[model samples]
Structures are given as C-alpha cells and as structure tokens.
Target chain A: MNVGIVIVSHSPLVAEGTAQMVRQMVGEEVRLAWCGGDPDGGLGTSVQAIIDAMESVWSDAGVAVLVDLGGAESNSEMAMEVIGEPRSARIRICNAPIVEGAVMAATEAAGGSSLATVVATAEELSPL
Target chain B: MSKTMTRLTSEDMKALIGAMQAAIAENAERLTALDQAIGDGDHGINMKRGFDAIAADADAICDKPTPQALSAAGMKLVMSVGGASGPLFGTLFMTLGKSLPEDFECGAFADAFAKAVDAVAARGKSSAGQKTMLDVLYPVSDALAAGKSVGEVAAVAAEAAEATVPMEAKRGRASFLGERSIGHMDPGSCSCSLLVNTIAAWISAKEHAA
Candidate 1:
C-alpha cells in the first residue's frame, strides 16, 4: 500500500527539517507536506497549500499528518474538514512525539504497510 | 510548582510511559482543542504520536538503566518527531538522560529534572515571561530546583500552566498571532503540565512500591 506523510508546523524550518530527516530513513517513498510558513512565491499561500499538496499525493491508502504545536493541529483538522469527504477518512492525524513518529512512520512506509499499520507503529513510540 | 518526590525505578518509569501514552491518547481531542484556540491545533495529535512511540517501546526502554533509557527515548523524540517542540522536549529528556548518573539515587532526580528544564529553555530560546512552555516549566523546574516536594511542584506547575491563559505567545507558532494568542492557554505549556503531573505520580508510585 502507498503511504503518505505530512508534517505541519508554525515554522517551515521544522517541517522541512523533519521531512529531510525522514527521507534519510525511508528514502523517496514517503509523501511529504508542510502546512504553514511565510508565503514566498509558490511555497504555499495558506493552510490550503498543505491540503492541496496532500490531495496530489493521496490515494485510497490514506495519509498521516504530523503537526508541530497547538494551532497547526487545529488547522490540519480544519483542512481535513475542508478537503471534503473523500480524502479525510484516509488521513490519520498523529500527535505523538514528532521525531519518534517520523522514524516509526518512515520505517513502516519502507516496509510497504497500510496507513493503519504505520499508525500503529508510530503509536508504539508513545511516551506514556 | 515545585514538588520533589522519590526516584523512579524501571517499573515506575514504565508505568509513566503508559500513563503518558494514555494521557496523550485520551486527551488528543483536548490537545487539539487547545491548539485550535491559539495555535496549530495538532499539539495533542503530535504529542500523542510521540508518546505512542515511547509507550510501545516501553519494555525495551525500561530494560536499560534509568538515564540511558530516558536518553534513548529523548533521542527518538528529537530525531523521529517533527517540530520545534519535538526537539525542545527531546532536549529536555536528553538532558535528563544525561544528568542521571548510572548509580542514580532518589535525591538526584529533582536536580536532573531541573537541568532538563534548563535544556528545554535553551532549546526553545525562551524565558519565563515569554509565555511558552517555559512559563509552565519554569515554575515547576524552579520548585524542583529549590527542593520542593513532588506534590508541591505539580501543584505549582498546574497553577502556572493555568496562569498562562492570559499571557501572550512570545515564541514558536503562537507568537505569530501576537495579541490574538493572549487569552488562550499555551498548548505546549499545558502538555508540559500533564507531563510533570504524570512524572509526579510515577515517582509517588515508585516510592510506595519501595
């Protein structure tokens, strides 16, 4: 199954950094999306930019969205809502420790697992 | 919020791992709610993911000595998780992991915890008034540093966390909102409170078990 990963944060640097880090583990198989950042050229205009990116990479397999802090989660939820009915169900939003989740997700993606499998793998890293 | 408690054993730390996992999972909605209020709304979700990874690895994590286990977990958080808070929180754990001596004793946990908080402050580039997790964590760490009881520290931490509601966001994502973020409680601060609270309970349990 195809797996997609999205990283959302107030700082684009954090998102970019996470995606880059994940790439080292999972290679090019993971779909990467960054939520909010300074609008410069085609990077993204609003949260919707992230949503659009998500849509482009999405398939029936679903996507996992990882967010940085408070509002990013809310915005992702809103984006899921606004992304309409079809794509929302496939998306799983994980609030675990960012680094751990990325590692788990990356590993599972490399293994060619479903969204549920990857989500389960990520949860195993929970702090308690 | 300073309350010094006993040192945690392997079992105690495992329990905390479980509690933290459950807290993040059960309160995912609340975390999202808090984030939605002032910031990105994924604080709960992101934290929950991080915790899940930690908890799932609990057996292997607890198998090691206290500090090593904590450090390993911290590294996982820093490398695996994404976001400023990820590295910040990860740094806190990593500091704790390092500060903990191989032959750790009850008396040293508080000092190590305080050091961990200092690391968080450094990583987040925040001080108390800036109204980030530092606002909540500082009071707790200060209490711990001052040799307060664990219960005492948790109480103060909870209070400080609640007090953050009126403060403006001065760092990270919420900072972008300026005045808009003032009335809402900082999500990172809130999560830190939960973490401190859970840690306190874990120590208490360990003490009783001993």
Candidate 2:
C-alpha cells in the first residue's frame, strides 16, 4: 500500500472538499481519508476525528496529514501522540495548504513514494 | 468562598483548580467582549469549555504529582479548547510539566516557566511584541526568572495584557484587523492573564495562611 493522505480542516466541508481534490488527482492509487470540525460540528478541530481519519488511512508506507489552520495542525499533533509508537513515527503533518498538500501528497504516494517523500512533495507545494 | 481559594495543598489543589476554572467561567463575558472587537468573539467560550473539562477531572488531575497534573491539564485543554489556542496554551502547560520538578519550587519553576514560554512561542509560530498571548507570557517568564513573587507575577501578567493595547497586531486572527486591532485587548492575552492571576491568588493566600 502507498503512504496514506489525510486532510484536516476547521470546517467539515473544507475537509471533504480537499479530499475530493486528492481523490480526483490520484484516483484509487493511494489510501485517503479526511476529518474536521469538533465533536459538536462546530468550527474547530477534533483530536478524536483526526485519529479516526489517520487510522482509516494507515499504511506501512506511513501517513501524511495536511491541515487548513492552526487548531487543525495542533489537534493532528495530539492525535499523533495518541496514535503513538510505530504508527505515530510513520505519520507526518505537512506544512502546506490543506487542499494543495493533500493532492500533492496523494499524487506522490500514488507513485509508491515513501512517507517522507510524499510529505516533502506536498510541503513543497506551498508554505502555510 | 468559591470565589477564591484561601490555601494550596494536595487537597487544596482540587479547590484551587476549581477556583481557576471558575475564574475563567466567571469572566467569560468580559473575555468575549474583548474578542468581539478584534477577534472572532469565541475566546471566552473556548477557554471556558477547556477549563470546564479540566474541572470535571480536577480531583483526578490534582491527585497526580504536580508535573503530571500540569501535563494532564494541558492534554485536556488541547482536546477541548480547539482553535489555535488549544495547542498554544497546551504547549505552555505541557512544557511546564516536562520541565518542572515533581514538587513545585520557585527557582526551578521560574526556569520551567521560561521554557514553557519558549514552547508557546514555537507552537504559535509567533514571538513577543506580537499582540498574541506571547506578549504577556514573555514578561511573566522574565518576572518569574527575576524571582518576582506570585502576586507580582500576576500583576505583570495583567499589565502585560494591557500592554497589548495600542500595539498593532502581529499574529493570530486579531492581526487581520491591521491597525484596528490596536484598541481592544487581545483575547488570548486576557485569558492567559486571567489564568495566571487565579493560580497566583490561591498560592499567595496559602503562603499567608502558613
């Protein structure tokens, strides 16, 4: 399996929209998932939701996460801690825009790139 | 009175935590007012939500060692607070937990607090002189490292938060206002000072009681 790509954003629609872009860009070549919004569907990020997304897209090739804003990134970081150990070490949070990063990471992973390469490819898109 | 706790101890930590949480809950409107002018007007609600979660586990968190309790509270905040604030404030408490002794001591506490300030800056991707929480945090860290009393530190936090006024924003949602962010107090700074004052009041009262 290729490195997985997960999209995180403060808005649920934004997360799903970004995932749509990634899927359109790379099709079924790379595993993918997306999550956003708080438990109550508020304008915030949820650690639980992020962890669930990460788990859904987990692969030995590792996972790459792209976030739209600060809370999204931080909650994803907390999710990493919760994931812990072997899986956590494999995951990387890309410092790029959620939509662009997810697409680029998915495209690279579809080529069977490693986690680090996929992250670097996505982060190379734009600095956020 | 639940308005304030008069002592701090193993048992007192629960009451002190309650007081701290109450401090945020009680001032939620004031904080919301401040944010309404410059930010998204959710700082008060966000902070209260996090502190309320902390209150739910006050007994359990306080039962742990001081460092562990701080760390636990930090984790709680990250999961509950949300926004950029979740990680920023979370870094502050978590770093303190990592850097402090099992028991709290002023000298080590000062050093640890300084570390926490640095961690906050790193996590927020901003630094002092920005209209962010780092403005208050930096001076408070300095005051602590200089051996200022808890009361004095509290005062510093209050003053530092006020100091944000008239300064153009350099970071966070408030920064989008440009010069318009100059008048209102930064919501994050306000909440940080509120928390500092609550903790300090209880500690100082306990010292006087002894």
Candidate 3:
C-alpha cells in the first residue's frame, strides 16, 4: 500500500501551506486533506469532507491524519469513531509539529518506508 | 520577580546545550512513546538529530562568547534539522542570543527568554491552549515576565507542562485523539519544560556558585 497523508487545520492557508512544504519533501505520492477553514462554519462540515476523502484513499494504504486547533481536533475524533474497523486500522493521528511531522512522514513514506518509520521520523518534530 | 541577573559565559552556553542534549537522549524513549500515541513517534529521533548536530559543533560553539555560541547553535539546528521543531526552537535560541547581553545577567535573560518564547510562538503560529509546546512555554514565559526567578519559573513551567495532560489537544498529532488527547501531556510540551527547567537550573546553580 502507498501510504496516504491527511492534514487538518483551522485555516485553509496553514493546511495548504504545510501540504506544499511536505510535498516538496515527499513528492507526488502522498494524499493531503484539510479539515477546517470552512467559510460556512468551523470544522463542522470539514469532518465529513475528510471522512469522504479518507474513504477514497484507504485502498492505497493506511491514512495519516494531522489536525489544527480545538474544533478540528474534536471533529477528527468523531471521524475516527465513525470510520471504524479495517479503515481505521490504516489511519493514524499526528499532532506534534504538523508541518515538520508531515514533511518527515511524507519523506519516509515516499521512500517506501513503513508507517512506523514515517511516524517515528515525524514525531521528532514534537517539543517533548 | 526578585532582582537577579544571569551572567552567562561561554561555559554556561555549553552547559545549557549539554543539558538539552542529555535531556533529549535520556528521554528519547519516553518522548517517542508520547509521540507514538498521538503522533508519528519520532520526537526523540528528530531531537536527537538536532542535538547531536549541536553536540558535534560543541567545541566550535564553546569557542565563541556565550551569546555567539548560543546563536550559532540555534542557527545550526534551524539549517540542518529537517523538522518544524528545529526551526521553531532554533528561532528561540537565536532570539535569546540576540536579546542576551555579552555579560548575560539573570534579569536580562529572564526578559530575553520571554522574548524567545514569543519568537517560537510566531514561528510555529502557536499559543498555550493550542496544545503545542507553547502549552508549557507560555506559562514559563509569563512567569519570567512576572519577574519570577529562574528556579521559580522552572517549578511553574514544569507544573504547567505536566498540566498539559488531561487537556484536550488543540493542535498537533495528539489532536486526533480528541478526548483521548486530554489525558496525555504533549511530548513537545514535556520536552519544552525540560528545556526551560534546564536553563532555569543552570542560572540558579550559577548564582549559587557565584
């Protein structure tokens, strides 16, 4: 499976910006998703949007979810709960340094590395 | 809050750097565990990478005066480390280097350290409740701004860092955990507290020795 990447943020700008940076590190293979910055509301509709996106990408590989802000976070949790079982198994949530984590994870995934490897590399960006 | 100064020398910078290095190395597993739960589990790996780089240039950094050495170290981390924390943290130290005086005093460092926190926030676009490292960092900065001594800041920062546990993540990987994130402290916040405490301890020890 070719691992997928999802980035959720409070602002579309942040999500898109981080995606652009990670794309440079990982190239064309990774999938990107934004869960917030919806003009109509908060992360309300974005949750369904991400869930829909995840549904489409699961066949490729496990999906990695990165979120921004409180509402987006809560919404992501809802998505995870609803998207149960095998699909859920393929998904992981990364919160540390989003841009840094995404870039690291993408680079590792692009290199045909395992989720563990990418996740490990991505976590290095966290402050703790 | 009391009037004191942080008179750092080249030796002091080295010690602070050393403390950061040791903290990363020693806490690698714990850091990774925290990350793996909410993130990709490489907090230790990236920190090790950045700190290892810092250590490699230790002698060169130590050769310069305290502020210069600290600045160089920050620059090195930003340039070489390929993660968000690298640049964000690198900016922090660089800010400190810029704000700190040659004869670094505690009072000056406290003020400068607060500025350093601002730099990190600007770089990361993060704040205390956002559940990034700033969760710990903000409280510490506020303590310093309130004129708390290094030891005082250290205690408060450490407590604040620990308090991150049980708080739902407002940002980062743990954010996905939603409510689950509430029970766990952010690895970044955890490490940031270590950084703050290290600096505070260094300052306090220096004062005691003097």
Candidate No. with top DockQ: 2
**What lDDT tens digits, residue by residue, belong to model 3 across residues B1-210?**
335443555676678789888888898889879877876566666667778889889989988877787788886665444344555677778888888887744468668888888888766656778778888877877777777766788898789888888788766657667888777778888888887777667767776886
Q: Measured with DockQ on alpha carbons, how good is candidate 2? A: 0.58
Q: Per-residue lDDT tens digits of candidate 1, residues A1-128?
A: 57887777666677778888888777886766555552232211234555776787687888887765544554565457557787798888785767668778867866779898888888777766
Write down the lDDT of every candidate, Cα atoms only: 0.73, 0.84, 0.71
Report i-RMS for every model: 10.3, 1.7, 13.1
TM-score of each prediction: 0.61, 0.90, 0.60
Per-residue error for A64 in candidate 2, Å, reads 1.7
Tens digit of lDDT per residue, candidate 2, span A13-102? 998888887777789667999987875578888788888999998978899999886678778888898899977999999988778778
Residues B168-209 of candidate 1: C-alpha lDDT, one tens digit per residue: 888877888898988887888888888888877876766577
Assess the local accuracy of residue A112 in candidate 1 as a C-alpha lDDT between 0 and 100: 77
- The segments of candidate 1 whose C-alpha lies over 4 angstroms from its true place after superposition are A1-128, B1-8, B206-210
Against the correct fold, how does model 2 do in TM-score? 0.90
* TM-score top scorer: 2
For candidate 1, give the DockQ.
Answer: 0.04
The candidates, ranked best first by DockQ, are 2, 1, 3
